[model samples]
Target: MASFHFELVSPEKMLFSGDVESVVVPGADGDFQVFAGHAPVMSTLHVGVLKIAGNTNAPQRVFVRGGFADVNDSGLTILAEQAVDLAEVKSDQLMQDIRDLEEDVADAKTDAERARAQAKLEGLKALQLAVAH
Candidate 1:
């Protein structure tokens, strides 16, 4: 099977780096898939799950806060502000975070602030779905 080098990196550390058959990323516009020999491109990413199909038996999942994906002849590079492996994510913590965001949204004084909180809540819901499976 054909594969491409996929690297997920954050400012604090390198999360995952390996060769994968394909990757599904949450592009700013929507979701997009990348395969081996994919055309070179760059895009802004949203807060959502990134799924990578490696050579192993199971696929890997990572939740990214926000970032940019740079795909080139070399490979795919994800520069994320925050990224967490789904396997390592704690459900309790995530639930707590969701609750906090909900409260913030309720108390939000301005439309912009409410929108931001809503976005955060939506991201957390996506993360929950990713972690569930």
Candidate 2:
């Protein structure tokens, strides 16, 4: 199968950089997949798991807090706020983090702030569910 270069980076470090057969990204609007010769695009990502398929040990699933995805002449690049490999994400720790986010939702001062916090909480909930499988 043909492949394309894919890179996933967070503030701390680059989590992945290699050729991939395909990549499923959680776009702000919805989930989308990219393949070789895909049209160039810039998309804002939502909190969700990024699925990478290729010559990997197993299908890679990485949790991304939120980020931007860019596909250009070079390849696909993900600039994530925070990212963790599903295999490395501890369920207990994730639940506790969600609890903290729930508090933020409750403590939100403005309607907009509350909405934002709620969205983030929802994303985390979705991530937790994905990691379960």
Candidate 3:
């Protein structure tokens, strides 16, 4: 399979930089895959897992919380707001966060607060499902 240079960066640091066969991005509109020689494009990413198939290492999955993906002649670059290696995520911690957010949702005093809590709860659930898979 053909490979292209791919980079995943966040405010804290560059998480990934390598040649990859393909990448599955969690675009805001929907999921999309990019390969070498893919059409040039830009997309906003949602809170989801980004999958990378690389040349040497085992396939990797990283969780990204909002970002932008830019594909051009050089390769694909993802400027993520936050990135965390799926393997490094502690399930217990995630579960605790979900439980806390659930309580926040239930205890919210205003409509805006409830909405914010609900959205966070949904994102956390999605992350939990991703970890399960």
Candidate 4:
């Protein structure tokens, strides 16, 4: 696969900055991938996983709350609202996050709100399952 400079930034710090072969992001509409020479685009990300594969290390999976991804002529940059390495997340913490999301689903007032919350819950569950094994 071809490579391109990629950066994943959060409020706290710059999580990853280097060349990567592929990046799969959880876009608000759906999952999409970026590679070298990809067309320029700006996208809003949803709560889900970002998979990074490259030459620097083994593939890494990151959980991002919400964010934006920008692909330009130079490279791809992801400005995440909140991001964490799935490997470092404790089971208990993940469970708490799930509980919170569940509450959001339960507290939703309208059908649209409930659907959004449910989508978030499902994404979290999928991430949890991926982390478990």
RMSD values for the candidates in order, in angstroms, are: 3.4, 3.3, 2.5, 4.6
5-101, model 1: which lDDT tens digit per residue? 9888999998777888998998899989999999998999987888888656333778888899999998899999778888788889999999999
1-133: candidate 4 lDDT, tens digit per residue: 7899999999999998889999998899899999999999999998788899885563399888788999999999999987878878788977998999899999999999999999878867867876775
Show where candidate 2 strays beyond 4 Å. 57-59, 96-126
Alpha-carbon TM-score of each model against the true structure: 0.74, 0.76, 0.79, 0.72
Candidate 1 yields a Cα-based lDDT of: 0.87
lDDT of 2 by residue, 1-133 (tens): 8898899999999888888889999999999999988899999998788889985753399888878999987779999987888988788988998999999999999999999999888877877987987
Q: Number of the top candidate by TM-score?
A: 3
lDDT string, candidate 3, 40-69, tens digits: 999999888998886556339988888899
Residue 20, model 1, lDDT:
87
Candidate 2: Cα lDDT at 21: 88
By summed lDDT, the worst window of 10 consecutive residues in model 2 runs over: 55-64
Q: Rank order by TM-score, top first?
A: 3, 2, 1, 4
> Scored by Cα lDDT, where does model 3 land?
0.90
Residue-level error in angstroms, candidate 1, position 46: 1.2
Query: Model 1, clash count?
Result: 0
